[model samples]
Target: MVAVKITTVSTRLRRSMRAHDDYAVRVGRRRLLVTVTAHPGVARRWVHTTLWRHARRLRSVDGITVGMGVQWTPPFRAMKYGAEPRPCTLQLCVGHRCLVFQLAHAGAVPAVLRRFLADARAAFVAYGVRSDCRKLEEHHGLKVARGVELRRLTGMGNASMERMQCRS
Candidate 1:
């Protein structure tokens, strides 16, 4: 038997809401403070500090949880004719902090983000991570040097898991 943990974050925004917001998300048994923003500066600062903190603590950064949302092209006549999906949002979670970047509003991808993604020492963890990395490369020219796919780790194939049970 195997046990897998998953976390989800959700929030409703008003019509006149600001570009940045904070929410508490539960990851496993801990509550994480997540910041959602469309500003490149804020995202860069957070990633910079996070990498610095991890470097000072362990000399290497790893176990970064990553998730992304894509805007699919409209389906008209045939599925094959539809344009490739465009990545809209990227979310990263580490320790008690999570940062959600709205890529559409962020304009260009930040230099810090590019460096972070390209860092070989930093391992990004996600389900179907290869596709995520591919999208980043294809859309933003960002290369992710290392990543760990949870689906492969758990041997779960393409099945979605909300809650996993383990037998000891």
Candidate 2:
């Protein structure tokens, strides 16, 4: 993903307050919120072909790169015993579509999904991407060949802001 240097500044400021959330613009990643609810589904090995068909329709339109994220609870000692663990939720945002799917088990991935991920590596805009890509590869065998790390790009933005303020 190409890094755009310009900051999306707003002059019409409104005072607001909010609690501390990981969703806040952290120093490392710039995660945007999804206001609209994401559609949900489950990934089953038997449904790999079905999943691939679904994935092909994911990037139907041109020029818009896909944005994706995952939510999951780490296995703790108390939750580790004799019970089915909660599934990891995968969130995907394409042009005008949003989807949330629970990954039942890893490694039964669709080929088209893998291809979409590979394409996203070069085209998508996402936050904390390295670990996300790693998780995709480690858990689902999807390798992201190359991509822009927004942490670095946004770090540059911060640096530029400070420099401008100092001059002002």
Candidate 3:
């Protein structure tokens, strides 16, 4: 498994961050806390471990909606010819942090991520989310896809789209 991780290079991710905190992401608008991932590495393993470790807390959300975006590469674009197109950049937003899952194959997403996403949908107070459940299942192999559109409560509206960055 290649694993998946989210780094806030776009939006502001901060929580009680210190001036000298190595894990701190930024200063000012960004609190720069390791609140997102525990291990704080440039690898997806760390993200998986952190989320897995805190699964209980994550699943306990009153309501969680994730904003998602898709990207198409040269190969996909070449075949598109203005076709319906396919998904590439899979971005998911919870609060201030956006977890951009740059899938090698959107349809072939890792089982663990699918599991977490499903759990988040079930636990979060997304009872009011009106999403394309059918489309999500057909394309992403999951019952629900979370995002700013998914989250009417605290998402950055359309800004969420521009703010989310593909974890490089």
Count clashing residue pairs in model 3: 12
Alpha-carbon local distance difference test for all models: 0.69, 0.46, 0.43
- Candidate ranking under TM-score, highest first, comes to 1, 2, 3
- Provide the RMSD of all predictions against the true structure, rounded to 1 decimal: 4.9, 11.8, 11.5
Instruction: State candidate 2's TM-score.
Output: 0.45
Task: Give lDDT tens digits, candidate 2, residues 16-134.
Answer: 32311112122223334222221111222212433354565544653335566756677776654554334365566544334445454333455555565566423455566676766
Best by TM-score: 1
Best by lDDT: 1
Regions more than 4 Å wrong, model 2: 1-63, 78-87, 105-107, 120-122, 153-168
Per-residue lDDT of candidate 3, residues 1-168 (tens digit) = 434454445333344333111234443356523333222132244337647555576666544434444444546235535443334445444444444454443234566656655664433333223343443555556555343233344453444423332212
TM-score of each: 0.72, 0.45, 0.44
Task: Assess candidate 2 and give its lDDT.
Answer: 0.46
The per-candidate count of clashes, in order, stands at 0, 0, 12
Residue 132, model 1: Cα distance from true site in angstroms: 0.8
Stretches of candidate 3 exceeding 4 Å from the true structure: 1-28, 31-47, 59-68, 72-83, 93-98, 105-107, 120-136, 145-151, 154-168
